[model samples]
Target: MTISRRSLIAVAAAGSGLLALPLVARADGTLDEVKKRGTLRVGVTQAPPWYSKDPKTGQWSSGLGVFMGKAMAQSLGVKFEPVEVSWGNAIAALQGNKIDLMFVLDATAERKQAVDFPATALLWYSLAVLARDDLPVKTWEDLNKPGVRLSCAQATTVDSFLTKHTPKADIQRFPGNVEAIAAFQSGRVDAVGMFHPPLLAARQKLGKGKLVVPTPAESVPSSVAARKGDTAFVAWIDKAVGEYYRSGQTQKWYEQSLADFGLDPKTVPPIIKEMIT
Candidate 1:
C-alpha cells in the first residue's frame, strides 16, 4: 500500500472535525475516541533504543518507539502523547485507560490474559553479548567455561538464560543493565549480556568490546499492546505494524534511533530478526 505524505496530512486534517466531541460519546471504538480526543496516548519509559527520556529537558527524545508513535499519531490525525510507564505497569496503564498503546512489549501468555496485542510484531531483539576483544566466542558453548566471567541483570531472563546454558561460566549479577554493563567496563567481568539494542549504545560509548550474537541466535518477537477486547484498535495496529515492516520503515526508524543515540548503525546488530547475520 502506498502511504504518501499528502494522504497522511489529509487524514490529520479530517480529524479536526471530531476534536470538539466528548471522548465518552465515542463508543464506536478506540480509534473513534482517539480521533475525538485528538491525541494518541502511548506508554513509554526510560528504555534506550525503544524509549528514552531526556534528563535535562524532561521530554521524550529519539528512539524507535518515539518515531513510530509520532508516525502512528500523524496517520490518525492526532497529537502524540507519551505516558511514562515502566515495563511492569504498561499493561495496567492500558487497563486503567491511562494509555492507548505501547510498543515493544513481549506478547507472553500471561500478558495476553490482561491485554491485547497486534498480530504483527513491531520488531525482534536477540540476546547478545558485549565481550572483551580477546574472547573467542563463536557460539554460546565457547563461553561455557570455568574461566570466563559474565555479568547480567539479576533475576532477569538474561540471568536465567546464562545459568541454564553457560552454567560453568562465572556469572555475576547486578541490579540492572547499567550496573551489569558497568561491571564489564570496570574489567570485573569479561562480558556483559543483555538485549542487543542497549548494548549498541554501550559499545559506541565505551569504544571497545565486540558485540556478538553468538551462533544459533536466540531472539523474541516484540509487539504493540492495547486494551483487551479492543479488536478494532488491535486490528488497525496490526495492519500498521505489518506495513512498517514490509516497507522497511521499521528498520529505518531503528537505524535513525541508533544514529540519534550517537551509534553507528553499521556497527550494531539489526533489531529485525531476519536481518541479523
Candidate 2:
C-alpha cells in the first residue's frame, strides 16, 4: 500500500517530542546511522490506541507504540518516523529491514522464529468477545458449535483463535476490523472478536452490547520486535523497555491513553496486572 504523503506528514507531526524516524533503508551502524540521519524509523498501523488516526481531526495519536517509540527516538537523539504497515506485513517489514522496529507485536512462539522478543514486555492484552445481546456466547464451547456465526478480522490473532478453537463454527472474515464490526452491528453475524481494549473502543462507538469473556482471559505479551540478527538495536530496545517498565512510566502512558481513546479504565483486563506489576 502506498504511504500517502498526508499520512507521513501527520505521523511526523504527531511525534513532536519524538526523534525523526524515516522509512528508508536500515543502515548498518544502528546507533551511528540513526544519529547521523537524525531519525529513528518505526512501524505503525491504524490499530486504535496502539496507533490510530482521528477521522474527524485527521491527526495521528502515538497511542502506546508511538508513545514508547518517541521516547526511544529521544534516547537516540533523533526524531521518530512512522511507516505504514498492515497487520499482515508488520513482521515482514521489520525482518525485511523496511522498518527498524515494530513497537507493537504479540510474542507468539511462532513469531519468535523470525523476530527476537525482549524480556521486558510493553503490555498485555486479553482476547474478549463481542456478541449480539441475544446470542448465548458464554464460553468458547458455545461459539464452537457448527451453526453459531462468528466474525473476526482476517489475518488476526482473533481469526486464528476462532479458526483453531472453533473449527466447526461458521466464521465470516473481513479485510479489517471495521468491516467485521459492521457485519456484527448489522446483525449479519453473532459476535465480533478482538482484544478487550479495542472492543471497549468499539463499544464507545457502537454502544456497549453483550461483551463477554468466552473463557479465562489469556494474557498475551505485546512487545517491540526487531530482526533476529540486529543484536545491537534489539539490545537497546530491551534496555529501553526495561527502564520504562521499571520506572512505572509504561503504566502511566497506558492510563493516559485510556482516557485519550475513551476506554474505561475499569474495563482493562486483569491480565495487565500480571504484566504491569
Model 1: lDDT of residue 178 = 98
Which is the leading candidate under lDDT? Answer: 1
Error of 1 at 216 (Å): 1.2
Model 1 Cα lDDT, one tens digit per residue, 37-141? 999999998877788778899999888899999999999999999999888777667766788999998887766656789888889888999999999987999
TM-score winner: 1
- All candidates: CA RMSD in angstroms? 10.4, 9.0
Candidate 1 runs further than 4 Å off: 1-26, 53-59, 153-156, 163-179, 201-207
Error of 2 at 273 (Å): 4.0
**Lowest summed-lDDT stretch of 10 residues in model 2?**
14-23
Q: Give the TM-score of candidate 2.
A: 0.64
